[model samples]
Each structure stands twice: as structure tokens, then as C-alpha cells.
Target chain A: MLAKPGLLVLGLALGLSTLLPSEAEAHRRWLLPSSTVLAGESDLVTVDAAASNGLFLFDHRPMALDSLVITGPDGAPVDPTILGAGAYRSMFDVPLRAQGTYRIALVSDGVMGSYELNGERHRFRGSGDALPAGATNISSSRSNSRTETFVTLGAPTDTALQPTGSGLEMIPVTHPNDIVAGEPAVMCFLLDGQPAADLEVEFVAGGTRYRDEPGIVMLRTDAEGRVTLQPSEAGMYYLEVSSSQDAANGQPGRRASYTAVLEFLPL
Target chain B: MRVSIAFAFAATGLAAAPSAAQEMAISVEIPRLKVAEYHRPYVAVWIEDAAGKSVRTLDVWYDVDLKPEDGAKWLPDMRTWWRRAGRSMTMPANGVTAPTKAPGTHSRTYRQGSRPLANLPAGSYNLQVEAAREVGGRELVTVPFQWPPKALTSASARGKSELGAVRLTTKR
Candidate 1:
């Protein structure tokens, strides 16, 4: 039963890509926190969210915080305050009252497609059932994407790192807050609660505006859906993994992508 | 029999301990930069083993005078020290936390058989000093030295911005 929906979503993603070529190539969405690790009494972390062509730069449109999720160390949802969306990016603050890690993510699941009506092709984004009534050559796809980062107040904990078993997710084999340069860190990717094997993961160091090359390190997941990353330098990094399944059994093609902003410190 | 044997070994170990006190003196220089907005940089000084595990945190210089909660908000700006040891420690650590200093040279001394260095094992260690400035840049300088110094040893490194010259001297 679980495999059935996976096949259907893959089909839908393929169909949607063919209908709307521009949407096939998605912009990079990210949530960059001011500090990934903190220690103090009553600390607050500010985060910036955006979908941009430049890594960590806010040249593109703002990422909406409507679907933003903040899971505190106790496995309970925490509300973010001082929320505001500007022209280029959205921002918010999460206070660290607890003594453990916090998971901050912007999760969105939507169906996007296009159809031909009276020989005019019209693009549609939203629910599958919201399509026009009398459209022909209808094609649609379902997309599930998550952009997230982690912040820890004191000692890091795993309660907030647990996977939701929905969409595409990454479970850190090495604690995200504990990543260090020159040491290999492992990350496991899961597609809808199962190991996502053979997926290509892109790791790019931040500060792209000053560099001529993007310096992207392309790595593939192992049979266990894990990737070992050894960052040479210590700084902020952006990681992205995406997968698309071909249309199967007349179902819409499905696409799922995950991105995270990680900070690696020098040993 | 076991208790008597353990006590005998402990007594012998204490008797074999070095009579002269060993100490390390660290000098950190925060360089003055010509910039529009110049805020004093937050600095962290510590010692690490060859494998990069933090052995001791000598000092942390941040906005310690600000409201308790407000100052620590920027502690992570000193990213290297924050990740290595700061994240695991409570803020305003007694005798270790101090206010950020103006652009100049500062010196501190840590003696063996003290709070932080009391339990340190003999090994090759790196004295790391990291400085981070708001609306500016960040830099780190490292000076390596060996414990139970064979002689009066001294080493230093220079940073272009945020930090100046960082020197470490060990005395037996």
C-alpha cells in the first residue's frame, strides 16, 4: 500500500514537468539561522528565509513562513515571534528557553500543473482538485519540499532530529550541531519514511558572492541512503537533495526535494 | 587489600609530582581596523588536543556587561570556540568570562594545578584564539605547545583582521 502512492506520485511529477518546463527547475529555498549553536540564559536566534539563485544571498523572492514549523527539544511545537516578510526574504526569531536542540523548518506540500483550455495553456498551482472544470490535455504533479536548519541552545539532543516520516527528510547520523571540519559527517536521506537510495546530494559552501566558482561537491547516497561529507573548510554550508519519479500507472509525476543550511566549525 | 593498595599508589603519585609550578602565558592582540562601524570583537581563548577536542577554555571576552541574556546572543559569532566548547558551557563562567576589550594587546596566565589546567594530561596541545567583530570579520590564530614543558617555549601567529598577534609561552 505504501509503495502504491510512491509510484503514483512519481508519475505525477513526470507529467507536471512536461507541462510546465520552468517549474521543473526549482529555486533554492533556505532558512539561515543567525547562530546554529548557542549557550546562555534565555537566548534568541534570528532566522532568514528565502528562495534565491545565490546560496544564502537574498536576491530572489522571500520564502513564505505560512508553513513554518518549529519543534523544540521536548518534541513540542514552539511558536516563533517577531515574524516579518520583506521583499527579498522572510525573518523570524525563536527564543531558546529550553536546554536542547531546536528544529526549524519551512515545509510545503502542493500540487502544481497546467492544462489547455480553448487552445490556451494555463498554469495551475495548489490542490489537485482545484483545477479548471473544462480543461483538456490536463497534466499535474505533486511536490513535497522542505528547507530547514538546526539550532541548539546548550547540549545537543536528538528528540528534535527525529524524522516526521513525511515527504523527503534527512536524519543526521552525526549531530548537525556537532559537525566539524576535517571530520567526516554522515547524513541519511529518507523518502516518505524509507531510505532514499542512490540520490545525488549537492554540498555548497556559503559566501558564493565573493567566489568565482560555486564549489559544489556532488555526492551520492550509499545503499543505506547515507552520505559521508568531509568539509575541508569551516563555515556555513548549504546542502540539497532532490528526486523525481516518472509517471507510473497513469498517476501524476512526483517530486521531492530537501535543503538544509549547516554550519561546520574548525577543529 | 585493594583499598590499601590504591591508597599507597595515590600517595606515591603525589610524592612524585613536580615541585615547581608550571604555567602558560597567552598574549592576544585585537587589531584596530578602519571601518564604518567598529565594535569590539568577541574573543575566545582555549587549548585543544591534537585531535581537536577542547582541553581547556582559558577565557571568553564578549559583551559581558550587557543584560545577562542579551550579551550571550552573539557568542556564536566566535564560531570556532562556540562549537568546540562554548555551546557546552554556561555563560559568564566564573573567573573565565570577561568584557570585550578595545583594540589592543592583552595578556593572561594559566598555571598548572588550577581549575582548568588542574586535570590536563600531558600531550601536545594547540593554543587557539578566535576573535569575531560585529559588522566586521572573524579570524583565528593558533600556537602549538607541549605540556610539562621541556624548557621555556614560546610560539606566535599573526592574523590579518579581527585578531592581531597571538603568542603562547610555556614555563617549566
Candidate 2:
């Protein structure tokens, strides 16, 4: 069983967030893998699904894995194991398998709790990780359409890094070419995509959240979605994105949320 | 490898320091005296477009004399700037300690000095101000200002006693 890593996010944020927040949740549902894990170096593909909560709703419960459904390259359902908690696992260590996309979805009818998402949904992944001979491209996050944010996948040869205008966010790949070895750095955010306006973006890097860095650091997007960040020290970094303004009307809880890509690119 | 890593950090940090040479400032004042029974304004100042769209976040000043629990409870009211820039940040004050200004004069300064603010494009934006006094009231006052990062004269606007006359000065 592959270990599910992000089950603790919501719990950790309880202290500062507003309970019974008036605003509906506008969160990135499933943080997809920006690109398929390289067959040469990586093997297993694990996923964690999160349910949405509308504004002012305070329902924080783990999604029970009552039925885990995964469709392989053949439009056939694959079996996954419920690891006792709010997590699920599947192994892709098969031989030179098929070259197609797979989807891993769940149906829990999510307990009738407090908050609801921007709409009705049970988490779904239209594509799974890739096999060496082929590839499976899935966005690292869903573009919470209600909030107008989009998610994109990355490729080894990606060149949109010079901060291309992609809608409400400008994705700047902060890691340079060769993928920064242990620190591959292509990040996603829900900004205006264009760089003409100074945006307030937040994320964690080298285990450190970059909400307030001194002065500022400039990351220029190259032809590819690749930008380089020479960390002042060798450490883990996470770039968390959120709204830079208050959702005016009735929505109360969420201030903002952006796409965060956890790439272990070592210098 | 470690030495190589050290050199890279040193290089980027040095590079991160933008060439310093521009500045921006604000001087907030209320014209007359309006003595409310007892309450100071929780003020938030930022820049936006004529269409009432927000552009740059300037500052948010709340009660520094609030208890830890009380502060946390009421802090979310500074919604505009918080959403655009504050949520991801941890406030330095555990309790409200900064002195609360009366219905008189107020001012603060911010400088890009020369580190060109990344997202502010060349155009027009409104220098806006909003205030919410505890057990008091809420009012939004705005003053428009143009941009290009060059030295500019003071921009001004006025309102009820809550927010008297607000002025902004920018030097690039």
C-alpha cells in the first residue's frame, strides 16, 4: 500500500481558518501530477482526493475508501486497497505495460456533513501516471472553475516558464533546465498568468513556506515552463497560492488558495 | 558539492536584491473632530482600478490592544487586503500592541525604492482606503493615482469623520 501524504492539511489549518465560513470553498480538488513520473527514475503513482466545502461550512472528515475504482488503459476498472484510514493505494510496478491513460475515482457519497464544494462531485482522476513506452498527463490541480483557476501538467521538455499568460495565473517554472536534479522547479498558481501586474503569491519551498521572503525574488519564465531558484540554502520549498483579495459577497472562509507543486529538485 | 551549493545561494540572494531607488508614501488625516463614544478605526489601505478593482495592497491597521483570542476573532474583517495578500502570512503580533490612532492624523510609508513591484503594470489605479471602527462604523474612501514608477505629486480624497482627508505620494 502506497502511503497517502497529505491527509493532515485541513487539520493543521483549523486554528487560523474561520469556522462556518460564509464563503463557499474554492479549492484545488485533486493536486494532479504535473507530468508523468519518469519511467527511468520513478515507478509508483499514488493519489489523494479531497472533497470541497462551501463557505461557512465546517465539516472536516476523512473520505472513507468504501469503494476504490480505477480504470486502466483499457477502460477497465483496476482494484485498489483501502489502507484502514482515509487513504487508498495501488501499485504500477507491472512490466512494460500499456501506453495509455487511466483514471482513479472514488464514490463515498461523502458523509452528509457541513460544507459542500462549489458543486456536487466525488473526486475523479481522468488519467493515471505513465508507463515508459507511453505517457499519462494529468494536471497537478483542478482549475476551481468557480474561481476561474486552471491546472496544467508539465513535460521534461516544457518551455512555458518565461511566465506565459494562461488565464488567471502566470505559471513560472522556477527551476532551470536539466530539471534541477533533486529540485525540479516548475510551479503553478492562480494569478492573472500575465506578469505585468505584481501579484501576491504564497508557497512553501524546501519544507519552508514562502509567504514572506525578504524584499523579493524574481523568477523569470523561459520558453519552457522552467525557471530556476538558487535557494539561499539547500532545503525543501513549498509555494502555496491563495487569493490576494477578499471574496466580496457572502463567501467568508477562504481568503485564497493556489496550486502547489511538490517537486524534489535538488541543486 | 556542498561548496558549489553555497556559491549558488550566495549568487541568487545577491541577485534577488533589486536595484534600490524608488519610493511610495501615504499621509492619512481626518479634517474635523468626531468624538465617538469610544473606538478607533481598523483601517485598510490599497490601490485599485476606477472600476473598483483592486491592484496593489498597501496596508491594514487593526487593534494592537486586542487580546490574542479577540484579535484572531476580529482580524478577518480586513477582508480586502487579507484575501489578496494576508491569509498566507503569520502576523507578528500575538496581541494588539501597536498604538491605536485617534480620529486625527495617520500615515505610513512603503518603498519599492527601486525594486520594481513585479505585478504593477504601467497604467492607472486607484489609491483606496477603507475604515471599520470597533463599536463604530465602516466607510470606503478612494483617491486615484497613475503609474509608470516615476516621481508623482500627492493624490488626495476626503470623506466623513471616519476617514477625513486621505493623501498619497509616490516617488520612483
- Per-prediction TM-score: 0.73, 0.33
List candidate 1 stretches off by more than 4 Å: A1-25, A56-60, A82-88, A109-143, A180-184, A204-217, A230-237, A246-254, A264-267, B1-20, B27-40, B101-107, B135-137, B151-169
lDDT leader = 1
Error in Å for residue A234 of model 2: 50
Top of the candidates by DockQ: 1
Q: B90-139 in candidate 2: lDDT tens per residue?
A: 44332212445766777776544212143355678787777666676566
Question: Can you give the DockQ of every candidate in the order shown?
Answer: 0.43, 0.01
Instruction: Write model 2 residue lDDT over A32-137, tens digit each, in one string.
Output: 2323322211123444333322111113333324434444444455554433434222222222133233333332111111221344322222122332222222
Clashes of each: 12, 74
Per-residue accuracy of model 1 over B1-172 as CA lDDT, tens digit each: 5345335545656324452256788889988788988999999999899999997898999998785347887888788888788988888898789999998899997766554565467898999999889898888888888887888888999998778899888877
Query: lDDT tens digits, residues A1-267, model 1?
Result: 122454345446556422121133356778999988787776789999887778879886677787889999999999999589899998999988998999999886777777898889876676657666788877777778888999998779999999998878999999999998999999999999899999999999998898999889999999889999898898889999988976667688788889999998776
lDDT of 2 at A100: 35
What lDDT would each prediction earn against the true structure? 0.83, 0.41
